[model samples]
Target: MSAATLRAAIAAPAPAWGLSAAQIGRAATLALHDELALAPKPGLVSFVDSGSHDDMDAHTFMRSLFSLRRYFVRMAELGAAQVPFAELERSGIAAEARMLAATGGINTHRGAIFVLGLLCAATGAAQALDGRRDADAVREHLRRHWGGALDARSQRAPTLPGGIAARRHGLRSASQEAALGFPVLFETALPAWDDARRRGLSAQQVRLDCFFSILAVLDDSNLAHRGGLEGLHFARRAARAFIEQGGAGQPGAPAAAWSLHRDFVARHLSPGGCADLLAAACFLRRVAREP
Candidate 1:
């Protein structure tokens, strides 16, 4: 590393975090690549953070960026597949609570969104351009269909109509969804979810409908971002600072975290979740693995 690079790294606001836009771009690449399993194990990528465990902002921002990208990938993949969600599930993943147990606590909504969005994006629903631009269309296809089911009252105390919201003992207060006895894999950042009972939808229907709106909003936001994509430049020195000072590569410290991240992409980061992680991982892997 050059003296200038070191100086810049030292001067960065979030020196511990490796989240400059350029690095983010790199993250997007890795997230996409990893999602596709094209070039796996991209190695340790870094971002700046306060080392605080209180919030999901760090991961959330990254996931949002990546997920949006993956959404497009999902659309592309769907164009080639001739099956339903059940068929997709037959060869795909169902959450393994034990496997995720090691992660301790995390903002599941943010983290899961990152993972799920990537998988979804990879499946060919990415960009959502084909979904028809009008929100009413999405509402017709996604809203009224499932949202109405989330309003039923359940006997469980901490429950919604079709699902229950509970704070997992050892984990961060992340919401889980189960329908007809199976846990579903998607989540949304929507706020009204807490009032599903009043909304006239069952927990199962609420879960599905929430995902629909989440995807639609994410897609719309992502398309706007993409319009300015090429013009978004990464400052060379800023890029260098992020990569060098990022806490992720401080010697052998990140092996476990890196391992988990690699595993995470494999297990989660599905059609709707991991585009950002894949792209980021790919970019970092390319940069690191290069001679």
Candidate 2:
């Protein structure tokens, strides 16, 4: 689909699932806000501070989210109509352009735009199929509908910094991760989120635990891009150690996370891929909770 066609689609009347699309879009934006508000996210930007990043901060993220609001709604509409993956990709490209424009060329939510956009599309498609908005249904629809295209996309040579780093280090790129249906998001982060809630942890603690769980396991090409193999290994080890010590549920967990945050800042390492997954997980959680 051409960019002009996508723009016209956006300006067109709402689809059958228009209300649901709007809700899905709001959920995605709120999930990003949830991520941004959470503090001491090691090597990530938040309301508390711009951990390890000097170029962008909470305000920049807010702007990116604002720019992406309509994009998510449009993606949902496209998915409900069962448009081709190319359409979704075009929407994402347009959203990324808007995000860059909003952030003044800073890449605040590029990864989120791709990751959460797919999830939103999947959710819309799933709802249109049977009114089932659960995570399993959404994921199944995503893979069933667009998995082949994603795999093909993963095979293409990448020019982005994170993709280049992944290729150089022999790690999975974001495209590769999405091609596999986002195993870290569906398997690791989502389960960790549920487990934390089952353990009666606070909302913040659940997010923290889920975030660390993703950091522990994901190849995190962003971390590799920023800190190399050594930096990535250090981050995985630190996250593992945090989980071993009872995660965010344990005593003094916040203090421990703060200490790790400082260490990550000192090393200039940012697990941006993990952060995006965390936000995706948050979106799934929100959608699942809705009737």
Candidate 3:
């Protein structure tokens, strides 16, 4: 063998544990892809349907994904550097601007940029330390390290639509979810995903189950914002009924879900908060798969 070939053979193996910034970013991107690919999601844009959105489609989401990939990596790097919450938010703001520009000023993945960005940072911080990449470890680190700052952010006066709607409707805002270290993402959505997997559900079926489960409980401000209190309640009831019927795993569940999707479109309702939680669940599932 040549000298170079011999050196290549003797190179040290990469660590089996801990994710680098690039890995974290890639995982986040893949999670976004997974969310976008899940079809027949009620009132949410997917590869196969626009679902109550006229400004965007699967292509728009793809562009946003391309724009935000490096942002997730940068956030992960910042986490490894132990930056403050303000710094993270600043980075996220810049990333959101890029996303908007890429999608021609239409809001696509705005919620994901916020929630998933923090998750990327938290994952980096967890893995950067003793390589403890578990979901509980990352969540604990997030709450222990930045919980105060997040709670403070939640107290700020409402500016965005989701926040305004949440305040008016007395529902928990996305900022509050971040402040509370995303209890629904970790405690609710992730477990539901795992349960669906264990029960031998298909990929699409698992995502549908997870989405309906989140919708049943989440006071989705987007639904309130678009459809009012009556619309929100109606959405929750519909989701609860679907989940009660064994979600997409039961016979005829997919057809029922499609019917509900059409109803949501007809009513101009969107469970955007539940969609964000689903993205977070996908991200956490990727992180959990490392071990």
Candidate 4:
């Protein structure tokens, strides 16, 4: 879809989904904030530092988030109306433009805009269908409604840096992951988060553990783009070692994570894909808990 078409869609009257759209949008925004506030996230931006990215910071992220707030709300409205995938794709493209403008052309939350945007849309669609807002329902609705589109999108030629890196290295691109209903977010990250919470870890620890769990397995294109396949494998190994040592439940776990963060920064390796999935997991968890 063209930018002009997206503007036309924005100008049109949006269907009312009551407070549901607003609520889902807020959840998506908060989920990004949740990811941002997490400190010592290896090779990712946090409130304390810019991680591997010297070009952007927490302030940049906040600006991007502010610009995207309404985008997510509109996505929810579209999902509730069961608009076609092309409409949602255009909305996301528009949101990405707003984010880049907000950050002076920096790409802070493009992945979040794509991942969380879809989840927010799915959440709205699920609610509209049967008032089901659980993670499973959201995933099911996303696949049922948009899975074909995502799968088709996955076959397109590489454009973004991440997609280019994925193709170059034979790694699964984000679109492929999405078409598979985000198996890493749904199967891996969320389960790791649940286990951490079940073990009575602190909120920060739970998130940190979940982050590491995702880094351990995700074929993060950001890592591949920055540090090549070697760097990606090194990051996965480091993350697996962290988990093998009892994760965030062990003493000095925070310190360990900090140490890994330093190493990742030194290596200039950023697991941005993992970070996006972590935010998605956080969004799902929040949505599930919302009344």
- lDDT of all predictions, in order shown? 0.29, 0.90, 0.85, 0.89
Give the TM-score of each candidate: 0.25, 0.94, 0.93, 0.94
Question: 130-175 in candidate 4: lDDT tens per residue?
Answer: 6788889999999989999999999999899999999999999999
| Alpha-carbon shift of residue 185 in model 3 (angstroms) | 1.1
The candidate that wins on lDDT is 2
lDDT of 3 by residue, 63-149 (tens): 999999999988877766557788889999999999999989988888999888988888877776657778898798788768999
lDDT of 3 at 261: 95
Better of 1 and 2 by lDDT: 2
Model 4 deviation from native, Cα RMSD in Å: 3.5
Candidate 3 stretches with Cα past 4 Å from truth are 1-16
- The Cα error of candidate 1 at residue 266, in Å, is 35
Candidate 1 has an lDDT of 0.29
Model 4 stretches astray by more than 4 angstroms: 1-19
Query: In model 2, which regions exceed 4 Å deviation?
Result: 1-19
Q: What value does the lDDT take at residue 100 in candidate 3?
A: 90
Q: Report the Cα lDDT for residue 18, model 1.
A: 19
Off by over 4 Å in 1: 1-72, 79-82, 87-131, 142-163, 166-291
**Candidate 2, 46-69: lDDT as tens digits:** 988999999998999988889999
